[model samples]
Target: MNGEDAIRAVDSLFASVKNADIRQKLGKPHTNAGEILPAGVDSLINSIGDIDDQDIFLDVGCGLGNVLVQFALQTLVSKCYGIEVREEVLIHGLQLMDETPSLRDYCGKVAIVCAEASTIQLAFERPYLTSKRQGLSQ
Candidate 1:
């Protein structure tokens, strides 16, 4: 799908998850909780430029993991990580992935973690580790 189409699809998938009942349960305005719309995701991706399959995308304070889902759907990134401090929000994000059939393909690429972004330890290999290994071999 084209970029616009993809954004629309993402928006549609998020609509149910972002409904009033969910918002009321969360006890805050979606905007105040840092929920980003699909358009924002599109803009963010555009600003970040190209994403190769080797690249890993991380979204700090990822409200509902919609950004991670969008990146996984639109880019070739090998992995997408979303860090959310709120357990409730993270639960909803997981629900969105589990209940949406269309999101199944991209769900494998996305991971939503419930923890403070600053406290979480990502176990993925760092670029420096690869470079250091290369230097030692050379």
Candidate 2:
């Protein structure tokens, strides 16, 4: 999809969640994962080792594309996909992507979808990044 379409897809997903209001009233941060990931999360993501261009990385419960964006920035993975159920979070990430001049270039490389974590598809049946794969750890 084009840049605007990518942006709108995220926006529409957020619109759906805002209309639902399930997580909004909980006082949780709308789109960021700062609450769940401890400090140095970005550093940890950057430190991941040995990912290649043919690998398709999936960010499960990817919130606002922070981790996914980081992944794309740090590595040369063939594709990076994120599945987040909340439209607000996905839209929020899209907004961030649109705002960041450098990240905006990655719109074509990264894909975000609004869907349940359990229902999301993965490129592999198992984790692509794990201790077993060394630098591929996620």
Candidate 3:
């Protein structure tokens, strides 16, 4: 699918889940549980330039995996990881991924982890970053 089509698909999937339900699930009086809209996703993809299949994308504080899903649909990034602290929201996001038929192919590439972003240590290394560091050392 193209960028616009991918954005529309993601937007529709996210729209299926109501904000009220998210707020209720969160049960926080003052929580900033907002997602990047389609426009923002478009702008983000543009700003990020080119994404290769070997590139890994990490979305810190990825709420509902919207951006991750979008990236999977819109880009060639092989692995997309979303770190979220709230288990409740993470559960919802996982359910969305599982239940959405369109996401079946991309789901394998996406992983939503329930953990504090700052404390989590990702095991995988980015090939581009590693090569860049090697070049610097040489």
Candidate 4:
């Protein structure tokens, strides 16, 4: 989608989500300061380092799921775990994925939760020492 189309899609998605607090947080215009990385938000995805083809990546405070989408498209993060506190933003991200075919495929490999970042835990399916050695080899 083009810029205008993307904007309209986001606007429409925002309209469908009903949480007041979430709406307030997302409805306002956003700045590209700390919300996005210095090298561009996609760079953050690249910084996650190597994992096996099946390892899951966790994105804390994933606002509109842009970083998650970028990683899903361009990297081998395998699965993405996005923690978003705002219900409206989460809904918008989900709806956007539902409406876009490529995004839908990306979403298939992702799990999103609406929750506080501090409370989210990262549990390893395998032991960290083994995973770290494997990640290094990759």
Residue lDDT tens for model 1, 1-138: 446876877887778763542353555544435467788888888887777787888888777788888898888888998887768877877887888897788778998777866676666655556532334542
Candidate 2 residue pairs in backbone clash: 13-87, 14-87, 14-88, 49-135
Candidate 4 residue spans exceeding 4 A from truth: 1-34, 37-39, 45-52, 124-127, 132-138
State each model's CA lDDT, in order. 0.75, 0.59, 0.80, 0.59
**Residue 80 lDDT in candidate 3:** 95
Instruction: Name the candidate that leads on lDDT.
Output: 3
| Number of the top TM-score candidate | 3
By summed lDDT, the worst window of 10 consecutive residues in model 3 runs over: 129-138
Model 2 misplaced regions, further than 4 Å: 1-24, 27-39, 121-138
Q: What lDDT score is found at residue 76 in candidate 2? A: 68
| Tens-digit per-residue lDDT, 58-123, candidate 4 | 778777676566555555667888888777777777777777764576567767898877786656
> On TM-score, who's better, 1 or 4?
1
TM-score-sorted candidate list, best first: 3, 1, 4, 2
- CA error at residue 73 for candidate 1, angstroms: 0.8
TM-score versus the correct structure, for each prediction: 0.76, 0.59, 0.82, 0.61
lDDT of 2 by residue, 1-138 (tens): 333433444444334333343344466556434323322434464466566777777877776765566556556667888888778757877776776564565555789989877674554655554434544535
Question: How many clashing residue pairs are found in candidate 1?
Answer: 0
Clashes (N, CA, C under 3 Å) per candidate: 0, 4, 0, 0
Please report, as a residue range, the 10-residue window in candidate 1 with the lowest summed lDDT. Answer: 129-138
